[model samples]
Structures are given as structure tokens and as C-alpha cells.
Target chain A: MVKGKTLTYGVLLGSICLIGAGIYRNEVNIVLKKAVNLCLECIGIG
Target chain B: MDKRILTQIIATIAMNGNIKGFFEGSIFKGNSKKLCVPGLNCYSCPGALGSCPIGSLQAVIGSIKYNFSFYIIGFMSLMGILFGRLICGWICPFGFIQDLLYKIPLPKIKVNKKANNYLKYLKYVILLVFVILLPMFLVNDVGMSDPYFCKYICPAGTLEGGIPLVLMNESLRDTIGFLFAWKITLLIITIIFSILIYRPFCRYICPLGAFYSLFNPISFYQFKVDKNQCTMCNSCSKKCKMNIEVYKNPNSMECIRCGDCAQICPTKAITKNFSTKNL
Candidate 1:
């Protein structure tokens, strides 16, 4: 049970860390650029 | 007052777009829009100070040139691990709207467990198809793809961003077409269902909810049923708004950690936060 619990926690946390590290390599800026747009088509206005 | 009310107020205010632009029906174009809020808020909502995570995710995935969003995935992963679908119960603007709508006096719709289980799978399908596959594969000549979920579904965006924009701007009114009409129909149906059912969207259509549900069992902040104290009288299960059998599965993906079961538990058998009960 302890091993199972540890494995779950470890994998989840590890993936989070890996993804977190990748964010600095331009993922945030790219998302931010898109987000700043009104995305008129998204709300069916365009 | 409920903690939910307080969180709702804070989230609303925090996400509230610029008041002048909001009243003028202009979506915020500020740098703050770059940030993603944890819950399902529409970025184009005139009052929205931050971006919707799902919208941001779709936009990133649907970009002409694919750029996987490490930032969004990481942020959401962290949130899921920390709180799971408690974000639905406590922080989501759309979920708050549903909660208020459900509180209105109306005949309710209660699906049987078997049907409910089947419906729960819909959101996962939406996540898989609309958010992921459609955007990833169905690209235009320029390689950009539509954020299909936002374009076709997501009543939240229609409610928060669509109706307001049309009401506030004469020019945008002319832009409304079959797509807008379709979204309006979806929005109206969602609102009516919310009044008659407990979070119908959360239970069956919200891809974001589906994403968070995946982490409910192992999430750090959720509830557990104390086997010692639980007498299996079914009081907690009855109190659940999400229709979960709390005693049988305190950590069920459907359990939103709303604390209703905890408040009503006859033997005080429910406890919140991390614990060995999950193990």
C-alpha cells in the first residue's frame, strides 16, 4: 500500500515538474499571445 | 455564508474585466489577459482579467503552427493534484452560475446511476475530441485549427462573452450568424437544465471538469470516509449534490468536495484534506 501510494505521488509530481520546466521554453508566451486576442470567432461573433 | 459564496465573490471580482470596457462591451486587451485563471472563465468576457484555461489550451493546440502548452498543462496539473474538481465547487465562474441557477425554484431532473455514469463519459469525450484531436489534426491550409469546443459548445463563453458583446455593440450584432444562433440555443438549454438539475454541465459536458476528475482519488485536497465512524446509514450519500455515494467511495471522481456530505454525515465520518483513506 505504501509503495502504491508513493508511486502515485511520485509520478504525478514528477510530470508536473517536467511540464513546469518546459513552460520557460516559450510555452507561456505563445499561450499569452493567443489569449490576449478577443477570439471573436470563439464566442461566435465572427 | 458559505465558503463557496466567498470564493465566488473573490473569483468574480478577480476575473472581472475592465468596468469601462465591460460596460462598453469591449473585451479586455490588457497584458493581464496573458494569465490563465484556474476555472472556466471566458477570456473575451469584457470583465475578465485573466484567460480561461480551457480556451487557452484550445487556442494553443489550434495554433497554425502547433506549440504544445507546457505552461497551461503544468498549471492545470498542479491545480488538479492540489484540489481536483473542488475548483468546480469553489472557484469556477460558470459553476457558480450553475449553482445559483439550480437554487431557483424548479422541478429537478434526476438521472439514474447507470445513465448518469454514461453521461459522465461525455465530457471526457469532449476533452478527447473537441479539445485535443480536432485541434491537433484538423488544420487549415495555414495549419491553424478552430478551437472547436469554444466555437461550437461552451455555453459559458456564449453567456459570459457572446450575449454581452452583442448587447453592447451594434457592429458585433451584424456579425452574428448561424453559429451565434446555435450557441444561443445551447446557452438557453444549458441555463434551463441548470435550473432543473444540479450542475448538468459539470456532470456531463465540461471538459475541464472531466480533466480534473481524473485526479480526484490521488489529489492532495479531497475528503475521505472514516471506516470506523461510518455506520453506512446513507445520510452523506443523500446530501451529495453530485449524486455520489460518499460512504462507498468518498474519493469518487464525481464527488466535488463540496462539503455537503461532510456537513450531513451522521457519525462525522467524513474528513477533508489529504489522508491515508485514499491508500
Candidate 2:
């Protein structure tokens, strides 16, 4: 049971690390670029 | 009237607070658009303040420059790990819409248990295929790919973003074609199904729900069933819209953590968040 909890927290920490790496890589900029523009496809107008 | 309903309402309003955008037929261009919302709210919804994680993930994955999105995946994983499908129960605008649809004074159709078990796996397939595989592998001439799930399947996008945007903009209305018609058809089908079945989309269609379900057993927020207090009366199971035997599996993947089971447990056997119960 302790092992399972450890694994869960391990994954959580790993996810946070990934988020940090993504931010460093300017991936959030990609999201902002796509989001700021009107996505015609998303609205089914394309 | 319940806390859950209040939370859902507040989440919807807080996430889509740009009311002027709706009136002006424009999308919000705020800094918050860079952040992904935990639940499936369409970013193109005129009033949306944050990006939909699934949509943002697809946007990043489908882009020619980026094959994957560590940020979106990490954000979604963090949300899943912390709350599981409590986001679905208490925050998702689309889920709230389905819940409202199901409340209409119409006869409900309970799916057969044998078929339901198999049907629940479909969303996982959608997450893998439409959201992940197709976008990553199937590219246009320029090596960019479409957000296939958002473009083709997501009824939430159509209902919340597509219809409203098109209605508000004459230029957009002129651009509508078979794809728009098809999306509207899907939206209609989803609405009808929501009335007949409790959260058919969340149960069998939402990729976000499928992704969150993966962490339900291990999430920080969890349900605890006290074996000592339980009466085996199955009141929790009876109250569960997800058809989970709460006493047997308090942390089932299908559980949205709606707290109905905790509320209905006659012996007060069920508890949420932190508990000393073994399972």
C-alpha cells in the first residue's frame, strides 16, 4: 500500500516536472498562439 | 440547490466570464487563454477564458513544429491525479449541460449492464485514435494536421462555440458547409441521448473523462468505504448514476465523484477525500 502511494506521488511529481520542461520549451506560447486566433475548425466553420 | 450544482454553475461562469465577447461575436484574447481548463469547455466559445485541455493538446500535437504537448499532458495529468472525475461532476460545462438535459420529465433508458461495461471502453479508443493517433500521423501537405476530435466529433464545441459564433457572425454563416451540418447532427444526437441516458457522453464518449478515469483509484481525492459501518443495503449503488457498486469499488474508474453515493449511504459508511478505510 505504501508502495502504491509512492508510485502515485512519483507520477504526480513527474507530471509537474514535465510541465516545467514544457514551459521552458515555450510550449505555452504555442497554446497561446493557437488559442488567441479564432479557430474556424473548432467552431465547425472550416 | 446542492453544493455540486452550485459549484458547476460557478465553474461555468468563472471559466466563461467574457460576456462581452459573446455579444460582440469574438473570442477572448486574454492571457488566461494560454492556460488549459481541466474540463471540456471549448476555447472557441465566445466567452471562454481558458483553453480546453483536449483541444490544446490536439492543437499542439497537430502542429507541424510540435509533435507532442508536455504542457497540456502534464496539466491534464496533474488535474487527473488531484481530482479524478470530480471535475466532470462539479465543473465541466458540457457535463452540466447533460445533467440538465437528463432532468427533463422524460422516461430514462437504463443501458443493460453487460453492454455498458463494453461501451465504457469506447472513450479510451477515441482518446487514442481521434485525439492522438489520427492527428499525429495523418497530416496535410504542409505536415500540419487538424484537431480531428474538435473538428469532427465534439458536440460541446458545436453547441457552445460553433452554433453561437455562426449565429452571431454573417461571414461565418456563409462559410458553413456539410461539416457544420454533420456537427449539428451529432450535437442533436448527444442532446437526445443525454435526455434518455444519464451522461451518455461522459460514460461513453468524452476522451477527457476517459483520461481522468485512469487516475481515479490513485487520485488525491478519493472515496473511502468503511467495511465496519457498511450495512450491505446497496443504497450507495442505488443512488449512483454511473452504476458503480460503491461498497465494492469506491474508486471505480467510472465514478465521477458526484458524491451521490456518499450522500445516500444509510450507515454513513462512505466518506470522501481522506479516510482511514483500507480500500
Candidate 3:
């Protein structure tokens, strides 16, 4: 269906744009900041 | 025994390839942690090489400075559109564990269809409430919130990250408290249920699975049942671990695209197509 194709391509394009925006905003560092440390909460220590 | 299981093993090893961390009792803190793996891997796992999207999303949303994460959302969306729950079927370490557990000689319990239809919605509710709302809305005096799902619900985090870390670190054992006990209980229940059921968590608990299921109908990679070759044998439906009626709806939200249906189809009526032509 054309609708499915449109939605799929639309989402793909939107994802690329969002990724670009995230990089520009230095959001990767946010993930890094959290992941690099031992998350006691994630381990259910808290 | 199959390519899918082999792929699962390779992916599990690939994502948690920091084998040294398992021995050291410390999680990997390398630059690779910036990337998010496509499955429900815990970032806190001792050998994990990448971040978990759900946890990262919660962190960003729960932070005072931000209520959204463009990178994680984008990454998850891309994966969802491309492969949907194929990630659940093939690559997820937890999923692989469940598959292996289900292979045990224990009798499987097939949930009632009516109950299953309703229970499947619980994952969506969990995604909205625990993964999104609680983290975004409930904050401490410092304007920060907990990763609610990871703290309270995720057996993957407890099993992959918690138990190993505790077993390795004697100091951490002293900090074990009610939450840890609760998580351990949950993990035990999940393990037991996994033996009696095919992917009980994936069917009724995993928010990540719920997220990916939404894209099944429209994902670039999809299933198509050929009308010409179809015999309506219904064997595919009977064999589906997710309990999907493949011939009736090849692109059901419940289908993980494990290719079991395609493999079982006597006439090879089912095909995994790369085209996004029909929704």
C-alpha cells in the first residue's frame, strides 16, 4: 500500500533528522555520561 | 541449532563482548557505551558494550535539563521501522535466554486466547506509565527522577547486570536491600515462567517489545503470504511461538518474524520480503 510506504519513508526521514538534531545538541554525551558509570539504580541497589 | 539461534548467540556476545568486565566486577566504561544496542540489553551489565535505549530515554526524560532524547528516540524508531520485533526474535540476549529456557523439557502452558489478548496490552501500559510518565513526572527535590522500569521491573537488568555485579563485588553485597530482593524475586519468577511459556516477558511485559510491535505492519522488512501458493494449512499458526495466525495476518503485531511460519509452510507460501509495498 502507498500509505504504508509513505509512513515508512516518512519515519525513516524523521529518524535521520532527529539523529542529526541529537548530535548537534551533544546528546550522545548524555548517554555516555550515564552509561560509563555503574548504575546502582539499574542494578536494583537503590 | 538454527541460523536464528546462532545469530542470537553472536549478537549476545557482540553486545556484551567486554568479557573482562565480567571478571573484574566493573561495567565497561568505554566510548562504545555511547551507542545503543537494538535490543533490551542493560547498560549496567558488566560486559555490556553499548547503552540501553529504554534506560537512556528514561535518563534523558528524568533529567531536569531535558524531557526528551532525540538520539535514542531516533535510533529506536530507525530500528523499529527496519526490523520491528525481528530484534526480539533474533538478537535480544534476554529473548535468546527465554528461547533457550523454553527448550527445557518442562511442559509448556499455553495461555488462553482471551486472556492473552488483554494481557498483551499491559506492555503498552508499562511503556507509557513506567518508562515514560513516572520518570518524566515524578522527581526529587533536585529535579531528577529514577529509571523506574529498571529499578522496579526489568528482569533483564537484574539478571544480566545486578546478579553478576553483586556476585563479583563483595562490597555491593553489603548494600543489598529490599529492592534487590524484589528484583531477585522478579527474576526468579521470569526464569520459571520462561520455562513453562514461550517468551512470557516478550508477550506480556516488555515495553521494548511493545514499542517494536507497533512497527510490524509498516516496517521495511515484512512478511507476505503468497495467495497463489497458499494452501491454508494453518500449520504456520500452530507453530508460531507468539501465537499469531500467520496466513490470516502475516504482518500481525504479534509476529516476531522468527521465520518459523515461512520455514514450516509446506508450499513455501510465506516469504520474508524487503519491499514496503503493502501495509
Candidate 4:
């Protein structure tokens, strides 16, 4: 039980740190740039 | 209405409800696409309202930066730890489509248990090779790589986005090549196998499912079996589409947490629980 809790907390903390860094690095725009465009290559239309 | 039916409707709609994209021949260019839905819905799908986490991860990593895949990893981590493959059960567009196809009542195919169990590990191999390693190392001179899984493998993107867009736009037909043909063949095979076996892709080939399965052992929400109530009649096992022996290990990686076991347990031996206690 304690182990599961610890693992879960560890994952949560790690996620927070990553998300914080993503924001700091302006990664949301990177994701948005990809997402907003129709990925022609992905759909085999390229 | 069944919980599965209700959630399937909602998830399908949420994933592909961008009405304007259909007439405009454009994918939704919205802020929502910045957010990854916990399913395999293609961001390139004309009607898709959000990004796919796996695709996003591959794209970001392939851009040749060793920077952290923070946004997608965080989102996927939270989802994995919270409900595990419940996302596969209730939210995946392709999984829902497979369920609908399986309802067509074809003579089902069941592989022998030993082989079936061994085959489930193939998805992990796919996750490592296609989604992670290839994109990580197989770069060209420009220090960029392709999303090998998306470009070469993912039938969902081909079916959901490629076919639709090509059908809608005649110009896309000129671009058809060996890659497109291969993806089409894969989609057709997946569609056929989905009818023969329940979630064959999820069971043996889905990289996303592979990632989510990592959390099944320790996820916060899980299916619990009440050993005292179990008569070992095996009704739960029989009803399982994923072929899980639910009464034995309710939290097995093979289980999709679809509640079929709990729904079928004659003595109410299984229940969904949110507690941290071990089963």
C-alpha cells in the first residue's frame, strides 16, 4: 500500500515538473502548431 | 442505456464533432487541438477537435530535440494512473468502432490461450520500436525524423482521416502511393480482424494500449474481486471480450476495466473501487 502510494506520488510530482518545464519552454505552441495543421503525411495524403 | 453506449456516443462526438472541418476540407485549427484526448483519434481527421497523445509525442520527439515530452507525458501519466485502460474501454474512438464491428455477429475467432497471452506483448514491442526508438534515433541529415507509426502503421489515421479527406477532395487521389496502399491494406485487415476477435489491435498491436497497460498494476481506480462472493462459476471470464480471467486477477494488464466482469458476476463478486487497497 505504501509502495503504491509512493509510486503514485512520485509520478504525480514528475508530471508536475515536466508540465512546468513544458510551459516554460513554450511547448504548448509547438503542440498547437502541429495540431492545428492537417498532417497530410499522417493521413497518407502527402 | 448502457454505460458503454453512453460513453461511446460522447467520446465519438467529442473526438469528431468539428462540423466546420467537413465543408472546409480543413482540420480543426483550434486551441483544443493543443490538448491531447486520451484516445487514438487522429488530429488530422477533418472533424477531430483535439490532438492524439501518441501522435503528438512522436511528432515532438522526432523534431530532434532531446527536450522533455512534458505536456503529453504529463497528460498520459495522469490518465494512466487514474483509470488505466478505462480510457481504452470508454473513450477510444477506434476501440468503439471495433466494438460496433464485433457486434456484426460473425463467427468469432479465438486463439489458443498461451499464444494469445504471448501475443499481447507485441504492442509493447510496437510502442518501443515504432513510437519511441525509431523516431528517437532514425534521423536524417536535417536532424528530424518521421512519425514512423503514424506514417507507416496507424490504420486509425488512414481510416478516419485519409479515406474521408481523399473521398472529399479529388486532388488527394494524385498523392496515392505504395505507403497509402499499405496503410489501406492494414486498415482493411484490422477491420476484418476486429470482427473476428474482440479488440485485436488493442490486444496485440496498439502502442497506446501498451503504454496504458503499464499502469494497470498500480492505477488508483481498479476492478476488485470479492473472493468470498465468488463461486468460481467463471461467468465473468466467459463474458470478457479481452479474454481475461477476471476472478483471478481483476487488475491484470489484459483487463480493460470495461466492467463486463462486474456486470456479469452472478454473485456480485466484482466491483469497481477507487481505494488504494490491494485486491
Candidate 5:
């Protein structure tokens, strides 16, 4: 039962992610690019 | 007894700005200083003398308003490595509020034991996807301000940080929009839930707590278990608000080092030792 609950939660969280991605694809990409740049900048390469 | 006093003293020092000028909001001149402090204390909070590192990190990476802040990360790492989750348990003003809230007379609900273990991982997901990854990638520039945690989550930021700042700053009040209202709504929900649940944010949401848990096993301050004095009565687990089995795993990720287990140990087996030997 516990394993089942965990699986359910995993599916639910995954679905949320998928939906979020579908709705916010461009926004997510913009954020991701900025994040990558920040990380690179942190290492003094950006 | 002395430990609580020490914790209180440390909290006082951090709050009152006695030891260093940094604690009094004097460190970073610009907005970058606002992006540090791993704990949830909001930088804009009237009482907060220091910065909220998570908020700052998100803002630096997420918004089109700021630049990347190396100083914030450096400051946060210094605190994280030095005391780890100790701040979450002791120093954080928001943590203090939750501790006070749990004192109210109510029927406390513990998460189902079997399902509880999995809940510990949620904070890590929040840390990765929301706190770190999202801000870094979502912004127009590498150093733009996002405050992603505050915008999407972070009841503390909403309550202690956001509300007060907006109230005090007329300029912020004038610019309030749908996003601010959304955050305020999240804040209200969290506040209401916190009154009934014991450290709800710490248990299931805080990204900072997730970071600190990674260091718990190796952090200088740790809970030591003496197996010889074994009476597996489960009393310690019962006393825990975080719903962790203290005897089974005293240093478990969910263990907030609130000292309930140490205080209730019938055999006096649990001890919180602040030494690098464990590391």
C-alpha cells in the first residue's frame, strides 16, 4: 500500500511537471538559459 | 537546559546585530546583499538584519533586474558549512514562529509512517527545480533578479519578508499586481496550515532544510546514539514533531535536532555533540 502511495505521488508530481512544461515551455527555456549563464558566470567563464 | 539558552543567545546575536555589522544589513551595499543567508529569513523583513540567501539566489538568476551575486553564494556556503541545519532549528525567525505555533492546543496529525519517508525527498525536488535550476535559466540575463522561491513558494518570504516590505515601502504597494496577490494567497495558506501542522515548511518544503540534511551526517554538530543502552520503546519517535524514528535513525534527514528525542530518551542514549569527529 505504501509503495502504491509513493507511486501515485510520483505520477502526480511527474504529471504536474509535464503539464508545467507544456504550458511554460518558452518560459522554462528562457529561465534555463539564464540559469546556465549564471552558473557559467559563477565559474568566471560567462 | 544550557543548549536552549545557547541557542537563544545565538539567535539574539543574529537578530540584534551585535557580533558583526553584516548582521545589521551592512554587508552588501546594493541588492546583491539581499540574496544570501541559507535560512528563510527575508532580507526585506523589518527585523531581519541579514539577507535571505535563497531569495537572493533566485532573484539573481530569475529576474531581469539584477546581476549574478558571487558574494551571496560565498556567504551562504560559509553559513551552510559552519552550522548546517542548526540555523533551521534555532536561528531562523520563521522556525521560531512555527515552534510557537505548534505549542497551540490542537489535535496534531502525523503523516502516515510508511508514506512519511518519501515526503523527505520533496524538499530536494523544490531545491533543484525551483530554487536553483529555475532562476538560473528563466531570467533574461545571468544576474537578473527573479526571487523565484518568493514568487512561487516560501511562506516565510511571503509573511515575514514580503508583507512587511510592501507595507513599509509605498513604492512597492503602488506596483502590486496579480503575481503579488498569488504569493500573498500562498502565504495565507501556509500560515493557516502551520498553525495546525508542526513545522510544515521544514518537514515538506524548505529547500534550505534539504541542503542542510545532506550535511547532517557529516556536520560538526550531530546526534550520537549509544546502542548499548537500548530500550526500543519508540518513545523518542512519539515525541518527535518531524515524525522521524529517533532510535532507528537518530540522525535521520527529518530529525530537526529540536532535542525532543534527546530530552525524552529513557536510557539517556541520545546525545547532541558538537565536534568534528563525526565528520
Candidate 6:
């Protein structure tokens, strides 16, 4: 019974995080792109 | 069969983009743009399907143009309240690796009981000084980078995330210098020590784990002590890899919700439930 509950919560939380990732995909990409660009800049590549 | 082994296999497949590859034309690029996972897996890792929360936090915090990241914080809070350190035990790929490493033959060191109390606080210090405050304060106009943890400390970023990516990309290999070599060295050291020590990263440094731990006692999923059924056998503590005295406080910051104690308990005393208190 407890195992079932734990599994359910895990699945629910995992799905929420995944869905949130889907929704925020562009923003996250923009930020990472910028960060990577900055890293390249720091290394004198950009 | 060990449940952790099953979890590890599943997580590895999920992380490797096997699941995501089914939906997307290519696994490598599709998941790279997503939000970070709660654990320490790096965003740049070839196999990673999502971003790394700590890396994202550091990137945003360290950014010269941005002052704050509501997205990262909100995501972190969501994970914290929902599962607490359970994420560390169950979801984290690095944690799964550590579990496998500890299974190898070695002289396992049990940390001193008195010293253990003090050591748990180290992660909080790392979070405050290294992760948040330093990045917020240290930057000139150019902005600080990912701070001391990723650059100097995080072996997960070094191992599972760094080495494989660098090895795969020849352009990245050509670009590697002293810093890359240093990180590789740190990774090697961590892998060697992890064979004998249980989660040196989780115990000493992981800021994400530290943040989630603060919510452990009050999280939706928590350990409940029946109090009556406990036989005082100390069996639960003996089985716990996190070195927590489960009976004294099952919802301790050190408790990773691995379910080891619950499964091992002779009397079936420890259980998980929703916390009613604000603690």
C-alpha cells in the first residue's frame, strides 16, 4: 500500500517536472545559450 | 534483487535519452533545452534529457545581466516540498552511481557520530557562500561564472557530465586546457574515494541536496514514527547509508528517504506519511 503511494507521488512529481520542462523549454534554452555563449566569451571564443 | 539496481537501470535509460529519443527525431539536442533536474547531473552531459538545477541556479545567479531566477527557485521549491531528499536517494543519477560504487569491496569508513552532526551543516554553507551569496556578490560588470562548486568542487559535473561530453566532442577536446585537466583529476579522486566512502559529494558538498534537506521534516512525503512499535534494536540506523539515527528522528535532514530503514525494520515501526506540522 505504502509502496503504491510512494510510486504514485514519484510519478506525479516526475511528470510535473517533465511538463514544466516542456512549457519552459524556450526560456531555458535561451538562458543556457546565453550562459554557453558567456563561457565561450570568457574563453575568448565569442 | 535490489530495488536500487532497478531504479538505476531505469534512470540511466531515461537520462541517456532512450525514452526522449522515441518522441524526438534525435535524443541529444531535443532535451538539452529543458529545465534542470533536481539532482547534480550537468546540463551539458550528452545523456542528460533536461537541465541541471544547480548549474541553472549558478548560471542565472552568476549572470551579469540577470539579478534573479524565479524559474529555478520555483522549480527547486516544487521538488523540495514534494519529495525532499527522497530525490537524492531515488531520482539522482549521481546518487545511483554512488550506490553502485559503494557496493564494491573496500574498507567502509563510518563517520564519527559527534563529527557527523557538524558535517551535515557543510552543504548549507556551500549553498550560501558558494552557490548564492558569492555569485550574487562576486561578479564585476562581466558577471561571475558557475561559482566554486562546479568549477572546483562538483565531481558529478566532472564525471557523469563532463568527461563523456568532452570525449565525444573533438572540438571540446581541442579546447580543453588546465581547468579541464583539473576537473578530470577531481573526478578521478571522487570515483576512487566513492568506492570506500558513501556519497562523499552528497555528504560534504551538494548544495541542491542541502536545499532539499531543509524541507525534509515538513515535506508532503515524510517518515512517521509509530513510537509504540519501535523495538530500540538500532537496526534501522545500522542499515542507513546516510548515517542517520532513524528512530530518534526519522525525518532528519540526513534522511534521504531511501526506504532502507523502513524495509529493514523488524517491527515495521517507521512509515512514510504527509506531515501535519509546519516543521
C-alpha TM-score for every candidate: 0.95, 0.98, 0.98, 0.96, 0.73, 0.82
Model 5, runs deviating above 4 Å: A1-46, B1-13, B16-35, B62-75, B141-145
> Which regions of candidate 6 deviate over 4 angstroms?
A1-46, B18-27, B274-279
Off by over 4 Å in 1: A18-22, B274-278
Q: lDDT score, residue A1, model 2?
A: 76
Q: Worst ten-residue run, lDDT, model 5 chain B?
A: B25-34
Candidate 3, residues B1-279, lDDT tens digits: the string is: 689999999999999999998898999999998889999999999999999999998988888778788988899999999998899999899999999999999888998889999999999999999999998889999889999999999999999999999999999989999999999999999999999989999999998899999999889889999999999989999998888989999989888789999999999999998777766
How much of the true A–B contact set does each candidate keep?
0.53, 0.75, 0.83, 0.62, 0.00, 0.04
Evaluate residue B25 in candidate 4 and report its C-alpha lDDT on the 0 to 100 scale: 66
lDDT of 2 by residue, B182-277 (tens): 999999999999999999999999999999999888888889988999999999988888899999999999999999888888889998974223
lDDT of each: 0.83, 0.90, 0.91, 0.85, 0.61, 0.70
Candidate number with greatest lDDT: 3
- Across B129-232, the per-residue lDDT of candidate 6 in tens digits comes to 88888778888767755455667667776665556545554575577777776777777887877887888778877899998887686677888767899988
> Number of the top candidate by DockQ?
3
Quality of candidate 3 docking, DockQ: 0.84
Docking class of 5: incorrect
Worst 10 residues of 1 chain B by lDDT: B64-73
Candidate 2, A1-33: lDDT as tens digits: 776687678779989998998898888988998
Which candidate do you rate higher for TM-score, 2 or 5?
2
Better of 3 and 6 by DockQ: 3
Collision count of model 2: 0
Candidate 6 CAPRI assessment class: incorrect
> Model 5 over residues B1-279: C-alpha lDDT tens digits?
567546755674565342232233222223333223446765545454545667656654565543343444444544544556777887776777787777788877667877667877899999888888877776643455455665667777556545654655555567667666777777677676787888888878888788777656555567877899868888898898888778888767666677978899899989888755543
Q: Which whole-number lDDT from 0 to 100 does residue A31 have in model 1? A: 67
Clashes (N, CA, C under 3 Å) per candidate:
4, 0, 2, 0, 19, 1
